[model samples]
Target: MIEIIPVDTPSLGDRSYLGTDGEVAFVVDPQRDIDRMLRLAERRGVEIRHVFETHVHNDYVTGGPALAAATGADYHVNAADPVAFDRCPIEDGDVVEIGPRTRLRAVATPGHTFTHLSYVLESPDRPPAVFTGGSLLHGTTGRPDLLGREHTGTLARAQYASANRLARELPPETDVLPTHGFGSFCSATQSEVTESTIGLERRVNPALTRGEDEYVRSLLAGLDAYPAYYAHMPTLNRAGADAPDLSAPRRANAAELRRRLRAGEWVVDLRSRTAFAAGHLAGVLNFGLDGNFAVYLGWLIPWGTPLTLLGETPGDIAEAQRELARIGIDRPAAAATGGPADWAGDDKPASMPTATFAELATVRRHRPVVVLDVRRDAEWRESHVPGAVHIPLHELPSRLHEVPDGEVWTHCASGYRASIAASLLAAAGREGDVVAVHDDYDPHAMIARFAATGGSGLARHPL
Candidate 1:
């Protein structure tokens, strides 16, 4: 039996695959943390003989080179990719036999990037499975604008044609295994459907269902801002990355932490959002371990800025390190474990109060306050708190001066970004004026609630 396993990096919304015939195996799109793949291969008792990369990834550094080196396997990358490493360059139509019963075929799916390829696992009696890395995702395709606005239109059309090509060439029962679409920004749209096949995708996928012109237009229109850190990924990936340095960083004392903060370095607090809101060392940004910690942290932190992690436990710092390393942040400058008191020493920790949407509605009746919407532009366009000030979380630090001085209630789709914003505002010496909305934001419901509270709701959309 040909068994396939996915190594899911949920924080980055990507997956790497390990396919085996119970003896030898091949990996696809491995992350920088290759230890996971090594351990998985060891556990399966399969010698990793090959490593494959579908494209020059823009999300995270690839582990293909490292894994291949460690296992003496042939690292496979698209022949067209200008990677600064030695590897088995494979192009479309090339097929490699994997044992007597299995074969791997490379198919050019140039939508995610000009050189992207999808791999097909074929066996004698079983339906083929295609690893459509960032090409054909569940119910959608990879977003085409990652390359640049100039290439978006052409790539969107290519993406539509690519999806159609997969549907036409692959068997209906061919399993559609995609690398993006699980909340990854690379996806044109996120999909909750976990499992799908080419046949199923043809019925529901926009690329297959809609005309090329319409699909291209809609996909381009829906594209939003991606991570600022993504600009660095392709370069690092092309250069190649080794296994991450998972060794514990130099332990920082309270004095060292203060020194780093004074030097304008990032001292991130990896605690729960509630704990961070209750009390955290002043100037320490709250990334919080409870949510999509790595995604937002990697998104907001200035690339190459010295990063020091403050966690309640050593394990938290380790987890954050692993997540950050996947995005090519190899190591932390230092790490400190314990409560805010341990990191604060003699300094008084800053505190920010958190509120729910219902509480926000009640408070607005008696007093005037600024409702800062920290969600992305697309989210704000969808439906936001009516009349809320729009400044995306990623833009808040640079645009802090534009915020009207007042008691600011910052919110996002969920409380995560709001908490981070509140911490940033407090770190910027606006502690007295910021409140984190620690609640899920539903714009229409908020409109109704505001109406019931005798506030203006007619201008806001109501459901």
Candidate 2:
């Protein structure tokens, strides 16, 4: 029997697959932390024989080279990919035999990248499974704009043709396994569907249902700014990343934490948003472990800045380190594990106020405050609180001066980002008065509360 398992890196919204026929296995799109893949293979009692890359990734460093080297597996990458490392260069129509029953056939599916490939896993008496790394995703296709805007139009058309080719060529029952689209910005649009098949995709996917021009137009129209860290991924991926060194970072005391903060280095707190808002070391920012920690932290922080992590436990620090490493953040300068008091030393930990939308509405009735929305441009353009100043979280570092001085009330789609913004405001000496709206941004409720109080708190923006 052939067994396929998935290794999910939920923090980065990507998945690597292990396909095995009991004794031997192959991995697809492994992340930088290859230890997990090793442990998984060990547990499965399978020896890895091959590692495959659908494309040189643009979201995170691939663990293919490291995993292959560790297991003495043949590393398979597209012949067209300009990777520096040695690989078993594969091309369209290349078939790789995995075991007696399992074989992978490469089908060129260019769109996500110029030379993307989808591997079809065929085994006897079972439905074929297509490992579509970044090309064909669940209910959507990979974004064509990652390479560059200059290549977007042509790549988009290629993407449409590719998706159709897969649909027309593959049997409807083929199980579709993709590397991205579970909150990864690699997707053309966010996909809510957890699992899909070629039959399901033909019925629901925009690329399959809509005409090429309409699909391209809608995909282009729906595009938003991806994470800034994404710009660094292709470089690291091209030069084949090694296995991440997940060893504990040098321990930092309270004094060292204070020194780093004074030096304008990033001292991140990896606790929950609630814990972070309640009390954290002054000058420390909140990119809580409970949220999209890597994506936002990588997006906001000046790249290559010395980073120090403060977590409640060693495991939290380790987890953060692994997530950072996937995005090519190799090592942290230091780490501290304990409560706020432990990290604060003699200095009293600073706290920020967190309120709900109702509380914010009530406060606005009595006083004037700067309502700052830190969601992305797309989110802001969809609908937002009326009269709120918009600054996307990624752009906040450079655009901090644009925010008018006042008692700022910060919010995002969810409270996670708002907490980060609140911490930034606190670090900027706007503490005590800056309230984080730790609640879901429900526009209807916001409109009702403010409408009742003689104002419109929410305004809808036209597309």
Candidate 3:
């Protein structure tokens, strides 16, 4: 019996699956952390014999090459792709044996990427299981726009054809597993569920149900901007990421951290957003250890930026490092761990300034305050403060100047991003003028919040 164990990254809601018939196991679409898979192999008393990648991943760094090297297993990728690093190049119709009753057949499913492959596992006396990397998903298909604005239409068409081909070619009872559908920004829309059979998907998947031209148009329209780090992933995955070092980062003294900050290293504060807003170092930015840590860090921080970290404990620092590794940020210069007391002997505590929604309204009325709405474009278009300045949180550091010289109160759907923006706004030294509204806000109800305050509060009216 083939035992399939799913290794899920809850932070990103992405999954990698492990399949074994006891002695030999194969991992599909692994994250950068290979130890989890290794531990599973040890637990199962099986040897990891093979590692397969569906495509060059754009969301997180892949574990395939590193896993292959560690276990002396074959790491497979598409033969047609121009990967700089070595891999067992596979093509359509090529079969890979995993065990006596199990083997994987590579099928060309070129929509997510030009050379994407789906591995179909054949086991005796049972229906086949297809690992549709990014082709056909539960409710939607993989977004084709990751290749860029120019290739969107062509790839969308390709995705439609490929998705339909999968439905037609595979048996209805075939088990369907996909890598890109679950909240990874790779899918055209959020997948309703992570697991679905080919039979079930055919009945529900929009890509499978819609006409080819209609599917293409709908997919293109639904495509949203993915992380900027996505643009760098293909190259990095092709070249292969460096082996991860999960060891606690070397310790840096407060003085050294100060020096690094002066040297312009990306000084990151891995603390709770609330804790950070209450007290954090000047010029340091907060990305709470909770929330979408890896992807946002990958999205906002530039590629290969030298980094320094400040956190509360060894575990906190380690977790931060691991999250950073998820997207190929393998190294940080050093970490300064412990509370504010460790960093400041007796200096006054510092905090990222914050304001209440009511205080924000009061501030707005008294002066011309810039209500910076740091939500996504869609969220902003849906509804935001009537005269709020819109700049998505990820773009705030570089676009800080657009905020202008004024009392600025930042906000997003929830206060997570608003806190991060508040820190950045202050770190940019807007004359200590920025503050965060630490409240859970529904974008649609923002106008009502203003209207409830009465007297045309910042262009107040129901949205």
Which has the greatest TM-score?
Answer: 2
Better of 1 and 3 by lDDT: 1
lDDT on C-alpha atoms for all candidate structures: 0.89, 0.91, 0.81
lDDT of 3 by residue, 1-463 (tens): 8877889887665789999988899999998888999999999999998899999888888888888889999989889988877889899999998888899999888888888899998998467899988888777888887887788788888888888888998898988888877778887888668678888988998888888887887777666667888887788898987659898778888778777878877888888888887777777878888878777878888788899888898888888888788887877889888876676545555776776776776665666788888887666655567777889988887898788777888888778888888878777776268788888775444555676444443342232
Worst 10 residues of 1 by lDDT: 454-463
The 10-residue segment with the lowest total lDDT in model 2: 450-459
Residue 276 alpha-carbon offset, candidate 1, angstroms: 0.6
lDDT at 361, model 1? 86
The per-candidate count of clashes, in order, stands at: 0, 0, 0
Displacement of residue 390 (Cα, Å) in model 3 is: 0.3
All-Cα superposition RMSD per candidate = 1.6, 1.1, 2.6
How many clashes would you count in candidate 2? Answer: 0
Compose the digit string of candidate 1's lDDT tens values, residues 338-358.
Answer: 998999999988788999999
Per-residue error (Å), model 2, residue 387: 0.8
Which residue runs of candidate 3 sit more than 4 Å off their true CA positions?
355-368, 452-463
